[model samples]
Target: MANIVAGIGWHVIGAGMAASFYAPIEKVKKWSWETTWAIAGLFSWILLPIGVSLCLLPSFTGFYASIDPHLLLTIALFGAMWGVGNVSYGLTMRHLGMSLGIGIAIGVTLVVGTLVPPIMDGKASMLFTTRGGLYTMAGVFVALIGVAIVSWAGHKKELQLKGHLEEFNVGLGLLLAVMCGIFSSGMSFALHAALPIQEAAKSVGVNPLYAMLPSYVFIMGGGAVINLAYCFIRLAAVPRLSLREDLRQPGPTLRTNAALAATGGIMWYLQFFFYAWGEANIPASMSYVNWMLHMSIYVLCGGIVGLALGEWAGIRSGLLRLLWVGIIIIIIAANLVGVGMAYSQ
Candidate 1:
């Protein structure tokens, strides 16, 4: 029971990190989005993953050599899929605008990422076989409902603003949003696929707490390659965008930009760092529920952050009330998952 509580605490920290990971990027100056993102991806996906894994899993480099190479490839491929999903998010924003795009995209991501792995493994039936599994599943579905309510609130808020965005294209946006959700779930798939490697880590005297660390090395390495390639392509094709923006003023400006990206990237990676810790605390049977807990807490935290940032400043009282209702629902959903985890244990 204590372990389950610890796991929920760790998951909350990770989800909060996930919620705020993009804040540093918002402060980055005079760089194209592609450039800042690419730089951030470098620290988030490559530098940090390798460095942290080495600290936690000292044999991480050699650990891969002893495992089936195919397992590594599968994990990396899913990482690439997540990369594609990450990039698609920009397009989703372009077509749908931030409030609507994020609402839809994240909603889809929450559902698909939480549920697909069990269904794929043909263990969906197990969710109904136990009280814990049933509670977890209920929480997952309720989280989705909360997401929908929140999205509706966002839609109302956006409509109350000046007007719909000029570029809004619902048809294309919907399709892209769905695609992004499916592919964004790739991160979960990559981690799920690394189950074998996690077991191997445990057998080789790796501490269970750090066993999942090595998995990030391959997952994000693959993401880094795809993300960088896309950034390079974007830099070449866009007349106004350039990697040169990174060096425009050089000296302090360059250092600041680099620092911002590094901060953002490291913050992003920290989400998984705590997530792995959370997973380490749960029994394998109930571990899959952590993703749902992560997503639920992530959405709830994101909403709280939005409120803190004054994104709700001009909103009508009714809409704000509705948003609060949604937030409360998400909080309840996350607790339900935690209770489910404790019960299962």
Candidate 2:
């Protein structure tokens, strides 16, 4: 019970970090979106993982050499598909805005990421037959309701702010959101696929919490390949934005933008960092539940971050109240998941 509670706490902090990561990107000036995102990916998807792997698993290379090449390839391939989802996630936010985009994306993600693995593992029946699994399922349903409420409040807030919503491509945005949700779930699949490598990490005296670091190398490598390709493609297409110029000047604007991007990247990575720790503390049989729990808290905390940033400001009192109520429900949902995990244990 205590371990479950602690794991939940770690997830909360990680979620908070993820929810607020984009705030810094808003502060980045004089850089194209492609530039900042790619730079940030350099840190989050490449450097940080390598750095942490080296520090934690000094024999990281040896561990990787010992693992089956097919397994590594498989995990990295899954990550490549997930990279497309990561890219689509950014597009969804661009087309739909944070509130609607995250809400819809996470709702789909919650369903897919949570249930698909169990179904694939042939344990879908356990959700109904097992007490803890059933409770976890209930928590997922509750969190979905919470996401809907928050999205509703956001819609109202949008109406209040703009008098009418901006003319966005609702169909396209929804498509992107759905795609993001489906593909993002590949991440969980990637992690599960790398169990052998994780076990290898364990054999090398790496802490269970950090055992996943080696797998992240291939996973993140796949993402970096896609992201960097997209960024460079955009950079080439856009005559205005030049990596050469940015490098030559290296002024305060460049420095500041780089710093902000780095911060966002690090913040983004922390979500999974603590996710690993949280999962490490839980029993393997129930680990599938971790994705849903993590994402529920992620969206929940994201709502809180939006609130703190005054995203709900200037809305009518009623709508603001709705937003608050929605946040509370998400909190309750997270608690329910924790309790369910404890019960399952």
Candidate 3:
């Protein structure tokens, strides 16, 4: 019971961290997406992760060395692919608005993040052969229903906002968001494949909670590399990126840039922090549920915050109610996933 409580708490903390991540980006002024992403990458993908791993994981070096080079490379490559998704997610949010953007992204993540790892591990049968597996599969279907509802509401909202909201571009945003979900969830498969690193950490007497850091470092490092490349490419294409003039005219641009970078860095790392801790509390058989729970909470919190921030303002009351209904469906889906995991254990 205590462990379950801890798992729930950590999951909530993880969700909060994810929710707060993009808030900082809204603060960044004058800088293009390229500059902003580069700064965020430094904090999120590089400095912060290193600092945490060094501080928490005592056997970091030994464990890192013990992993197979080929496996590590594969994980890193997946991270790089996920990085592209991450960049696209930001753009999706900008174009789609929070409710629709997150709904679509989570839909993709739910499918990929939950199923891919199990399939890769050759446990695809577990999802159907066992009663618990059946429940989980059911939960996934229910969750998809919720996502559909949320997305439908978002679609309606977007239609209503067409004339009022100048920045609306629902079509492109939804497309990119779906792509983001698929690739972002790919990270879970990467982590699963790097199980050797986790074993190495166990052999070295490191706390299981901290042992996961090294794997994250490698994975996030890959993501960082890809995002850095993309940023550089954007920089090259846009000569204004070289302009010192924007820097000179900025108000809170620099400050916002620094803050966003720090926030994004910390936010990115917190997912694993909670994941590692949550893994400690749950049975290994249920690890896939962790991703579902984490992503659901993230989407829920982001949606709620978006509402609070007036992002959904001026929409009809009927539309707002519909959105809430969608949120409820997502909640049901998350609960089903959790229940299925518990039953499996």
Best by TM-score: 3
- What is candidate 1's TM-score against the reference? 0.83
* Candidate 1, residue 17: how far the Cα is off, in Å: 0.5
lDDT of 2: 0.74
lDDT per residue, candidate 3, 211-254, as tens digits?
67767788888899988888878787777785355446555666
Q: Which candidate leads the pack in lDDT?
A: 1
Error of 3 at 159 (Å): 2.5
Write candidate 2's Cα lDDT for 1-345 as tens digits: 888777878877777776777768656777777888888899989999898888888676786788888888898888988898888877776555554566666766665665676788898887788887787688678767866776676555555656344533456676787788788887878987988888888888988878877789899888778878988998888889887765555588878888998998899889889888888876766664575467666676666666666555566888867766766665566556656666765
Relative to the unseen true structure, what is the C-alpha lDDT of residue 252 in candidate 3, on a scale of 0 to 100?
68
In model 1, which runs have C-alpha deviations exceeding 4 angstroms? 58-60, 89-103, 122-144, 163-177, 285-289, 330-345
Please report, in order, the local distance difference test score of every candidate based on alpha carbons.
0.76, 0.74, 0.74
Q: What is the lDDT, from 0 to 100, of the residue 219 in candidate 3?
A: 85
Count of backbone clashes, every candidate in sequence:
0, 0, 1
TM agreement with the true structure for every prediction:
0.83, 0.83, 0.88
Flag regions of model 3 displaced more than 4 Å: 57-63, 118-130, 239-246, 249-252, 283-289, 342-345
